[model samples]
Target chain A: MAAKNGSEAAEEHTSSAEIRSFFDSAPPLKNSLEITDKLKEFLDKNSLSAGDGRANRIVCVTSGGTTVPLEQRCVRYIDNFASGHRGAASTEYFLKAGYVVIFLYRRGTCQPYCRSLPADPFLECFEFIDESHIKVREPHSEAVKMAISDHQNVVEKGQLLKLPFTTIFEYLQMLQMVATSLRGLGPHAMFYLAAAVSDFYVPWKSMAEHKIQSGSGPLDMSLVQVPKMLAVLRKEWAPFAYCISFKLETDKNILLKKADMALSKYKMHVVVANELSTRNEEVVVVTGDEKVSVCRDKTQVGCDVEDPLIKLLVEKHAIHIVDSCS
Target chain B: MAAKNGSEAAEEHTSSAEIRSFFDSAPPLKNSLEITDKLKEFLDKNSLSAGDGRANRIVCVTSGGTTVPLEQRCVRYIDNFASGHRGAASTEYFLKAGYVVIFLYRRGTCQPYCRSLPADPFLECFEFIDESHIKVREPHSEAVKMAISDHQNVVEKGQLLKLPFTTIFEYLQMLQMVATSLRGLGPHAMFYLAAAVSDFYVPWKSMAEHKIQSGSGPLDMSLVQVPKMLAVLRKEWAPFAYCISFKLETDKNILLKKADMALSKYKMHVVVANELSTRNEEVVVVTGDEKVSVCRDKTQVGCDVEDPLIKLLVEKHAIHIVDSCS
Candidate 1:
């Protein structure tokens, strides 16, 4: 008998018609499923390799950016732009595919999607100031107040961590330290260098001693180039890590050219090229040998193209796919 | 015939000795006033200097801390604890001293402060947030609708500038870059390393390539120590910049010791040590050579210390104080 919820099941199905036709023409679907299950179990127990001694199925990902302090006394600080939305999403998709992920990131960005998170010690929920406004008071604001109170109260009881920095130099030093550590993870690591690094930085000799006047005159300071950090990934740190770079461009032609350049220069496996426009969603995933361009009908609200990108990644790497990198 | 007010003044003068003493002290008071005016002008022209040509009168400020991303794609991050209050205060105090301040910070932390900032671009008014968040409507709930809306509106119209960062690595990188830039400013630059830097960072080898299964297991990853950023400050970058390290200790006794350690280790001119027990006010300034502690009667009601610590810094460094540092 046909399944009662046949349409619902059909909607859940993801295989292409060609694959379905092959299954229908060859062996029964149930038999193929059983074989796959048996194969997975066997592989799990024996650790079978696909005709090679070298394990060729590893992906490394780097998330988050560096931080900077303004001075040695641990006061003011600076940093570049990045939020981790793309990095986190890609991490989730990669994890779902049963591939080992090497995640390198800054400390403050979002924790991995499903990791055990430290209870927000300072989750003091504030109440509404009015009906439209939430004031920091009783039952309504208890949660936020509780959180902040938890953070503060515990400190009052003498337990708190206060880490401070004053300038950008300290921040980069920290990142370099972390990167050097990440290098130890060895090859088969896929470094998704999605961190938005700064292009220009304050030159210390010119800026360190200068008194910034209140009513400013013509203020000028010379800028110097920070050593190209991504280059370090390719050369000194994480040599074996499969490096992937991002090319954010305003023009389409320039983007493709830049992606090609990145692939050639950095030996990147994939380059995610995004157009820098207002609420733009289309992206091109440039591989070493081919380019996969995705155009989303962003006209519909909440139609995130990130999902399709995930699907493409999975399909390209799935064992069933002929071009599965793994 | 003296003024009618003189009648009241004469009635208050009960003693002949008091009248004689007032006349005697008047000449000296007038001299002292002249001296103060001369000192103020001289101080205005020449900033307080460290013996070695550095700006002895300097304060380092920092704001923001580790922000945890809420989403997987590297967007929508969260912070453990940061409102940038302390940083803003430090900047204000430094400005009052008639010193030049080269601010290096991201945008999101400074958005609210920008609205209140008296306009100027050189070193004032900088807002730091993710570039993406610059336009998009944040997930709106009624609680902070007003704040979120105001922040977003200011951001979209370019009223504020954002220096974005997604990861700790990038943030650190930018920091290093900017620190070097400031290093060029010569010995007068004083460094305050006070931004809340994250101590633990994710190792690259631990991230999963695909999403982990829903069923819970002992999900664990190795977190490595980020290098001692301050040590790096003393080592490579800004060797000449006057360094003031911050020591935030929960214990009063430890505060001085930690500050002492920072001073010795970094060879800093001063250390701003504080007890985190009280937020409104509780901090000490520990110059490598001396310790100036501000002890407030926390138990006393209505006893407000209008920046006792800052007042001390001003007295010590302001050229007007005849024998302040002495």
Candidate 2:
């Protein structure tokens, strides 16, 4: 909490105590029971009781950006700009690879199948035939058809479970809950951490009760470093899960170095290192042994690197299952 | 830009000079020319040369929240939580009252006609019949039809000109451009300012080229106060326009006092003071002479206070036009 402000941020609090204290001081989720119930239903459907030849592989994909609220009532926040495009695209690929995907995303961000449509003009893309009937406009008709059919099929078949979080507190808590819930799947469960989560936050108990007044001169706020929950997720919550974390940087020189640090420090199975300018075109996968550059087929129109990236990960997860069993 | 940090925020610079310096230091707009051309076309379509009995009234409605980027490349930002419901609703009322609206908004915020649609599951709202046809699902059919028809009609006729912005730099530049463009309308122009703008910002010149590396001790940043452009707007840019600014506060105790200060200091014709919790239920119209409480009819099921609020503002604007001519 703000009790130990930024100056005292990382000097103390062993990983366990930090995680425990962070959760202890956070405002309890308004709908934790509902989220838990939904997770239980989702897990029950994918349970081994189905008697399928092999347990269905499940992957939880976290997407979009998390906020750091500055007030208890939440008038202002610290945020990041993430279109959730990579996560959405990756989710589509994972589902196509026959993985049941839990899409943990920020509300109102880009969704798994709706990425092709124009960001604006949601209503403009349809022709109003009548009060009850509307036809999709050309150029958009095929995209709309594919999006709805694919989305509906996955959601109805219970292959995609969507959970949304906004604040950093909600994100970490939900991550813990999801990791723990998927614990029984062992090596079959994968955690693809793609969300741009806040690194620092003003703890709930220390937040202002009302909107911070302006014209009050330079606002000096003491934001505490958010506890590194990746360590907790790998070590305690889902030890057997194949975990992949991401590192994005504007400086190419420092990107791989940071990814290496995160890989070793958090014991991440693989760290996807991407630079800001060329993220969509290429990325480097950093693991214990080597770094592999994954690039899109630029010669082809509308080709995404996510296709190959997810395929590669699926293969890795398959190998992981074998390694764990042996 | 960061030459004078928050400590020297208010020490110097006349209102006009502050505005000048701010604009000079800001990053140039990527599409200023396009925005200007669109604004010109919109204005010319409603020009007085059409020999109409009276000049067409036009209002620039600024909506949603602006972001303050923490770095030059902008991996992080300070933002506020705003649904943009009030501004969107008010634009509809303004258009209904026979005024053309230039909706300057944050990209991806709510739109005037699309408010009733579900925030998530955009694709699920439609039933895919075939490649070319889609039917609106029941319970949403009527809303979709109305939203599409109304939005299309306005946009096609050029009655609603929507300009979107994200950062504080883009917002202020766009506002200045819109105001200066409408300067010819005189009292027929109205400025409805509702966007939750940043009060402090990391000056562009001083911002780091890359993301601020964490693991560094308590990130100490000296944010400069954003130059107040309201004074410049009233005294220089659109002096004769009927200006209405909004004040939103969490504490009701200081709301009116803040509103009064804004009214006198900025010479605003009306300052709409709204408390955060009760904003939709009621607001106090603060002006030179009096403060009047305006509330929605609690008896009605789907009533909104914006209807009555816009009606009163329109009446007041009419009086201002008459007074301006004399």
Candidate 3:
């Protein structure tokens, strides 16, 4: 699986062989086998083995920040800015839209339906009503109750499965396992690439074994571009699955341009473009044919932009499934 | 407060003037003034204005990892590896030792009594007993009750104060504010430096105003050393405060050497040294007079190393207080 020798290609464009080599050279996550087995078992019980003639539409929602380790043991890392709020919020909406949600998230990031709570939710949300009894605080009681019920309802129906990862290596490995397992589902599978993945990383073979010492004057290191796996995902992993990737930029001038490039270059079905400052308020969904603006409803108390975003994606996914079947 | 020109004398050695200059040149935290005022008020009420002859001994425990932003708008950052488990666990022990604790921690990191809870504690700990009533799950009920009461007890007594920061700028600014505020307490003040602070950063003046464009060939940038603030803390900020700093290393051969260097260079009262792999199981406490190996007790069901660690520190602090008076 390693790339052909002397394969240091241009930094901007990475070939499939280079991408494969990147994965081949990196050490596999300790729990990759266990996680793959769990994913297979989940799919079998929830979709494949079900008695119903029709299989449920399933979407993999990747959330939070993927860290690029500078060392093999990983004392330091480069991280994209993300709290997993968007992914977690979107997972809840996806479940509401009747899609089986595989929540692949960074460990300790925000969780679905728990986004509305305070940072230290458990400590701040509960109070001792009496000596022996404790109850949710009055101000947070309604939200807590609703979140619990909604979460429990999904769990009881076996519609939500959560898998967690911390580093870029773990995330990519798990993503591959998920995409391969979903291949049998054909067009019924969807990929929501919401996680903030790092664009560059220190290759595992050249990384320092111990913590990088600060005593050595200035720290100088070179990082290689992360292989564009979107192309491989579309071409080889799960060809018929509808994939939507996200593009977040601080500069509005280049946002749509990058999204368009991603759509064309990776053969992505759609790209969700968002500005770093205004991501919560609005987004632009760029497809091969059109660009649609999505905004949160100001009139509603808790309406999120994800409501409309997921609705549009589900509609597009439905059409794709039907087109493939015909 | 800026250092004199031509200040870059040595890479590893940072003068106090240079450290102060780093703060002066960097952008102040948005909430520094407000946070300082709050700290002052809290200290006044809890320690300075108490009617009894004795003032409360106060310790500031810093936890979690500080981030170094690669750009001004900060779409990406370099992060240190820390889950803050040790610091959070240590806070509970400090409170049990009858000292007021000001927990200065990275946002979203673990909390003192909430250490053992699940990642999404509130969501996982609660369930619907029936249609209208939600209650804590049976298995977690006892723990939930204990955590809540213990947290509330300290909160009500004004013994615990939590201040959260994310970036290196915020962490350093807040630490300075905290140290200066505790200056009046003399020997009664203690500092537990547990936060995994970044070793290098791009100065705010030189950082890109927007998200760094990945289109540029390879990211070639130079990061300046983060000015050593421990020396400033000991010499100027709160001279009489008993200070303990942590030294975490991946190589066991150099662990104690680095700890000793930190102790001598920064004039710290103690330095806790541990290897990354065995940090949980054992640690070496390095003081000027001796080095002691502290290990977790195997006989106790739930005994943590922090329990004994805090006890030793408290005893050392008490002696320091008495020594100062003599």
Question: In TM-score terms, which candidate is top?
Answer: 2
User: Proportion of native contacts in model 1?
Assistant: 0.00
Taking the tens digit of each residue's C-alpha lDDT, what string does model 3 give over A111-202? 88887887778888888676668878888877787778888888777789899998888898889889988888888899999999877777
Q: lDDT tens string, model 2, B71-91? A: 888888989988888888999
Better of 1 and 2 by TM-score: 2
* Candidate 3 clash pair list: none
- Model 2 chain A: ten consecutive residues of lowest lDDT: A1-10
Better model by TM-score: candidate 1 vs candidate 3 = 3
lDDT of each: 0.43, 0.84, 0.84
Ranking by lDDT: 3, 2, 1
Q: In CAPRI terms, where does candidate 3 land?
A: acceptable
TM-score per candidate: 0.38, 0.95, 0.94
Give the CAPRI rating of model 1. incorrect
Candidate 2 C-alpha lDDT tens digits along A153-240: 8988898999999999999989999999888888889999999988878878878888876663566666767888888898899999
